[model samples]
Target chain A: MEEKLLSGAELVIRGLEHLKVSTIFGVPGGAILPAYDPLYDSPIRHILARHEQGSGHMAEGYAQATGELGVVIATSGPGATNLITSLNNALMDSTPLLAITGQVATEAIGNDAFQEAYTVGLTMAATKHNYLITDASEIPQVLLEAKHIATTGRPGPVLVDIPKDILNQKAKWIEPKLVDLPGYKPTLDANPKMIQQAVNLIKDSKKPLLYVGGGIIHSKANIELFDLAQKFNIPVVTTLMGRGAFPDGHELCLGMPGMHGNYTATTSIQNSDLLIAIGVRFDDRVTANPKFFAQNAKVIHADIDPAEIGKVRDAEVPIVGDAKSVIKGLIDKLGDTKLETSNWIQEINEMRESYPLTFTQDEDGPLKVPYVLEELQKMSEDDSIVVSGVGQHQMWISLHWKFTKPNTWLNSGGLGTMGYSLPAAIGAKAAYPDRQVLSLDGDGCFQMTCQELITASTENIPLKIVVFNNGNHGMVRQWQKIFYKNRFSASELTHHTPDYVKLAEAMGAVGLRMEQKSEVKDVFEKMLEINDKPVLVDCVVDPDDMVFPMVPAGGSNDVIILNEEDLKKI
Target chain B: MSERILSVLVEDKPGVLARISSTISRRGFNINSLSVGPTNIDGRSKMTIVTELESVEQVKKQLNKLINVIKIVELDPDNTIESEVLLMKVSINKDSQTSVIEKANLSGAKSVDVGQDYAVFELTGTSKELKKFENLMKPFGIIEMIRGGRIAIQSNL
Candidate 1:
């Protein structure tokens, strides 16, 4: 075959095309304009985001929803800097994301040229791997390597910064091939001896618990996890990142186990003799005080990243591999050695019965966030992709909704980034044009990136966003009420501001308002019925509503405040 | 916290140092000494980091996670062969010149330059020896000093 000569910009487009990238979530700017010219003529659809952060997050949402590589692009300087949060969020959550940024020309670099920034320096800590391409010929190899690094074991965000001159320069096109990475070998197979040790521990354990996290979803190990739980009669508890990794209604499942987790899940972790943590870092939120968390348990942690094994809580039997392989190894080694768990199940069942995830509200009172979430869950499809911004609404949806599939529930679990839902929902919609996507956002979080509604409107992405309007930073206010002697302080928002419906309309989307508690079912149905364009529902709720089943920061999991009745005890 | 030393081999690429340093600082470990230079192998570099960390378990694993980092070895503080080089400029006079030259000669410090009012000397020694020499010159009102951070090779290796 004859050699192909292409410009650096053409190489970038061809590289993404060869990588099977169908859609790009990006914002064009001064330095990146060269690539946009090639992109304008390519078959790949580009969704022009309003902000660089929005572009980054939309890419994350697409990746999380479809388990594919999400691509984002930005220009240098402020554009590159604006992508820091989204990149950080992707790194924290282990999303497979790629960011292509434009930098100043090679000769002009470090000259402090217009729209110039040290993009590689800015994103070094925020991404899994990053490169600043000075040579135009390196584009093909960098793209392949960046994609591999971003999507492989313990997936994360990788960035490639191409100078404007490099983009404009001509280069010989090379076939897609990965450069030699001597230090980048990721362990894909679990050690057989370690798996046998884990099996022996499970066989010896009287009360075992399967503690799962986002790695289960990332590696698609939910089936193996479910099989292990059912065969052994062990209970399962998920982390925030592990929301949909196991069936929410499964008999062995105990929902999330942490600060806002249910009583059954939190208390059970403390009581278990052997906690098999699969694909989870023992985050502080889950382990509050490591001294008191799972005190009786000898943990067997299995994860793809060796660094996560003993970072927070030490694991007696650490199996370093991808989640699917580790769980498969456990199942293969265990055979049919089922342990006795009738009494353990009965104990946890009683905990569930006594302290269920419930809430109280008067029939004619202000709308409640949980009530809206419950109605939304009821009306939505079983496979609907649900997303949330940070704060009370996120917690409420996590506590109340039932997610039965992996990758269906997306949120800023690690970074807890506000303004994540709108752009992320747009990305999710881009991935699944036919499936329903609902961005359930808090008022404070909604106001942060509501501007993305314009992108959704212009792109014709039929995304549905429901704003739980409590007229305050709901979680902050709740914390102040409980921990700060009821002082309002800087936590309050005016009862009426930009008028969300009017704002939605001005942004070219249909908006509806839900005030009466009685209108939740009808309003949710109405919201879901619209399919022509993006829709937003402003739900005014009682500001005092707060998430329960709480473990005060740094407190033991055993010491949970179950409800308002327990609040009086405090 | 007890001090720990980490020896890392990494790809000699642009910004690899920034990436490694940021990783160390983000972990909240206060680095006491750090040195980096090209290794015997082409396209590879070595770095030595000393910090007030009780254990290098997390730090070592985190460093290994970086794609460019080739290898890491935790050196024993007591056993490793480590040295630091120092260059010092000192103010001098007829009264102190003789004592300064005699002491520096005894300590094996080589004079880089000599002048009527000042003198420069280069010294290579272990950190303890360097610290003692620093204290020795402190009394003579040391004008300026540049101390290379500690670099080490494992004794067994």
Candidate 2:
């Protein structure tokens, strides 16, 4: 708060501390080494990650769990480029992530010096906003502006590329203030007139369904969504990103709807007369051949980002606003009115009964992946945060887990990045040490970023991680089995090299292996009991088993493949 | 394709141009012509982009999402004063020199340079007029030609 001379690196650490940032994730290198010197003395705790990408996802995990800005730092060139995946992941999922990279000195920037990269150029499309700083005097304001931009109004990733010279430049320090961004104002509240029109459409519809997405969790509108659905007794179907936005076991909830969505959820979407979409982009995974998706439904789309409205499915009534404000507006304007959705609800319930999500567990066969998911969720507390990696296990968690609280379910939804579970779960545990954190990942996805388990162990962040090891890339084999005439090429994951139990022990974490379905409950119980360090469980299973109730790509929601029987019929 | 001109105002900063152009291209919209210049307002710039994509509304909305983009408006061709500068060099001898100069004068073009075997002329007008002049010089075997892309501003009534 005083006017004092400070180096650029000190200014950065001081500025972050001034902004109330207590934790950060990063990897140090030549360009970023100067910033690390100041960070050494700062009160902020910087978790050293093995890879820059890991640090970025850890930031994303922290941001999503706490509803705050997740910060990650790296050096230039390869270090900065490695962060592209995590930055893009945050961009797609709308997580507030701030990425700071150290560049070469100003004189060496254009000379192709060692570790110099055009980071700002490379990350232009990968971030929500970005900046390149060569002057030390701009550090304070740029730091403040970067955090503000990354955290507000349709949150996404922002980056600041600072030259190494700037990190050593001495400059007068002043308390940075947030200047209004004229071009960056976001629409928070929809027009009342538009809300009235949406209300009118809900009143006239014979069958109305609430289609929720991750935006509901981002906007903290779960209660409003539930109240609105309960008032009308409307059916609710959540997307993969919207898994925890609504309780899965509610009488009106039809579970997830999309390519791998439940049969009832998909059918209800096709048969609905009205679809009230909230905080969703109508991603192709959900819409599936947009022309044929929800043919009988008129859509009312609401989201914080205006560009998302009608981007995929044309919305008859577009409400451009945050989910909480729009849903609250709809609730207040509709004013305790109950709709006649009893017959509609009964029709969907019949469909739900005819085709529930089911898989047979053989007496002496390979461990079922879904069984592991259920056991983990059943053993853990209801409020335990769930994280997942991209593959069959990710879909299994979505299909099996019953999330009762918002922000409790985390995964790489839009980007679908593999190996996201371990570091992200560590991030969640870092944000909320009191809450239990469990991550479900596949054999293929777990190896991609499994090195981060060392960070968890060394940092003393205890996380229960389960790897459903089918000894191959499970999802690809399933697609090959169904569509590629059973020719499994490059799918075996090198015959499961590098024993996972040893890998866990080498990483300073407890290792548990589940080779049978009978060991699931005990393995999970023991995994939960360990609180001193992270624990990894490898549940070996059958590779032939695949995710069912799937609508093939470019197929209509009306056409769903129930099981191998349906595929054989094809 | 029905063509539309989008006039966009953006903050004067590095990488803003790349952001706008990339956003347009990634949306699968092809730009016909784009020109940028400093505006009267400090720390702000304006870009004139001509595209014939099916949905100008889609591109406009996408650009608005960029943090550097201040505002965007589609200019009405009827009320816009669109113009460009054209320079043309023609191969000419003693016989054709007089005739080329005559024709250039008829179109209000000024002869900027004259060589023993070639003549250079300069003109300013809308694309339609400059295109007509290009054709006229083609008969004389145009040696070279250059034209500044179109720029427009609304006519204040």
Candidate 3:
């Protein structure tokens, strides 16, 4: 084989291959034509999305699924601008993504020349780091650095703005030097002394509890956290972000605690003498009326971010380190020091037995959302990834879904951005082809990002989508029903929807809709039969059903509503 | 209460905002509004945090002990040199015009614009100097003031 030099565009394709980026989703334009020309013959498959936002989201999905850095390429101007929302999405969620965009020629930049804008400057606040490649020679190093930055530490989106001329310019390029960031070092070791102190607090306490959050997933510390909890024999309560962190069915696991969390979970936190908060940020949402949260508890927070140690609640034994490493250290120091919490466990069980998540309906009424989630859980594999759109569907999935592994459950917890699912599911499916990626979408949110189905179908990513179609923004409607005296207002959606099955067929995907309770399993089974393409299951759910045990905004977690009888039980 | 400056390096991740902010509140530490930016490193960030407390040293030591924290360097304002920049617009009257411009020159500041009613002066120096100048120019009639959030660099390496 003859050794040959490749152009900048060709080198980009080669670099993506080296980085193991198999998919490139974007919409092409004038400025990036050069790069797209080379993409055709390149091994990297390009997914033409309906919108640039969808492309960024697809890349985000890929990152979250595989734990690899996601990649997206867009052209200049409007093409670049369209990615802002998705970029912010990745930024806010701390997702690992690489967004590469074509820019005008270096000389033409700042002349207000055509589509030339300071893409790097424009994206400064939205990205971890961005580079404006004025020199074609810098592309390789920039690409490598972008990948490195996107995947390292706490993972975020990094952008590389390549000038149009640089992509077109031909030069004898020696490989750029690989530079080590001298200041970049993430600590993994937990100080043994501090770990022992924390363990002592737990062992000495009568009613110690564990408060888990998203940090467990972010740091991949679920196994370690579970082991520590089991060792201490402490009751566990999770924040909204920490749902599925522990097996929901685990004896020690007391569902989500905080505002809008279960009564038992919140009550357990309040009564706890020692709170072992692991990798959890006590957000105000999670600590509604924080003055009352765990009033009896002395917190021992172990988090990687030091700044988070005392932001919301004071920590008696604050261990600032990686959750996995710190928890492991705590376990080692624990060394079989089992604190007897039989009474505490009994109390928690009492709460669970009293105020559990339950809903009632007639045998012939509309489809219930919880049952849909339950059925989906039964149908999906243990390793399947579940993503949800915001609103009622998000709560249903969070409550019903039991996640066993890190990165298996994806939702916009912090930002709570609606219209998140369809695109995110596409991204997840692209990232993990072998694993089933399910998007649990609400009717309102599904419509918002439904256009991405075209991207999913065209790219041939087999995503399993379950839409809880109640024909309304069920959460807002529930709020209106509870707080606003059921005035309805603008919450009820009036727009008629396209027949989803026909719509899915139009996008080259298989769509199944279930109107009755009996039809649910068969429709899901039939959809699963088509493993070659994506499947959309639009289950018509009861518009009247609302998420139970919801703590109204700004209300105490203790102030919950669980139908009259359920309330009496608590 | 004594105050101290601690430079903390953290995993440049998104949720870090929650982690860092919550930590300060938990410790009963009042952060005087911090500034963060990317370091030379690919995925790491440096935060210049200001805290007022008697246990400044304790805060620094505890900060350095954090897992995401790569390093913590304490820069004392009393022992170390520091400066701040302000983009202030001052109202200039014809009667006190020359005096105001002369005062600006003496402070090593430059006036970027001069209008019939007002003028804007950009000053870069210590917070004390900026405050002193702002008081001195009050007689000339003050206009709107816009301050660029502080970016600090330790003078003594």
Model 1 ranges with Cα > 4 A deviation: A1-4, A568-570, B76-79
Can you rank all candidates by lDDT, best first? 1, 2, 3
Scored against the true structure, residue A184 in model 2 reaches a CA lDDT of 91
Off by over 4 Å in 2: A568-570
What residue runs in model 3 are displaced by over 4 Å at the alpha carbon? A1-5, A171-178, A494-496, A564-570, B1-74, B77-157
**Candidate 3 versus the native: TM-score?**
0.82
Task: Tell me which residue pairs clash in candidate 2.
Answer: none
Models 1 onward score TM values of: 0.97, 0.97, 0.82
Clash count for each candidate, listed in order shown? 0, 0, 19
Q: Which has the greatest lDDT? A: 1
Error of 3 at A58 (Å): 1.5
How well does chain B match by TM-score in each candidate? 0.93, 0.89, 0.75
Between prediction 1 and prediction 3, the one with superior TM-score is 1
lDDT of 3 by residue, B1-157 (tens): 3666777778775445455565566456666647787889898988877777654555664455333467777775656565567766777778878888889879877899888878888898766788887887777777877654444556654
Q: What is the fnat of candidate 3?
A: 0.07
Q: What lDDT tens digits, residue by residue, belong to model 1 across residues A289-353?
A: 88899989999999999999988888899999998998888888888776899999999999899
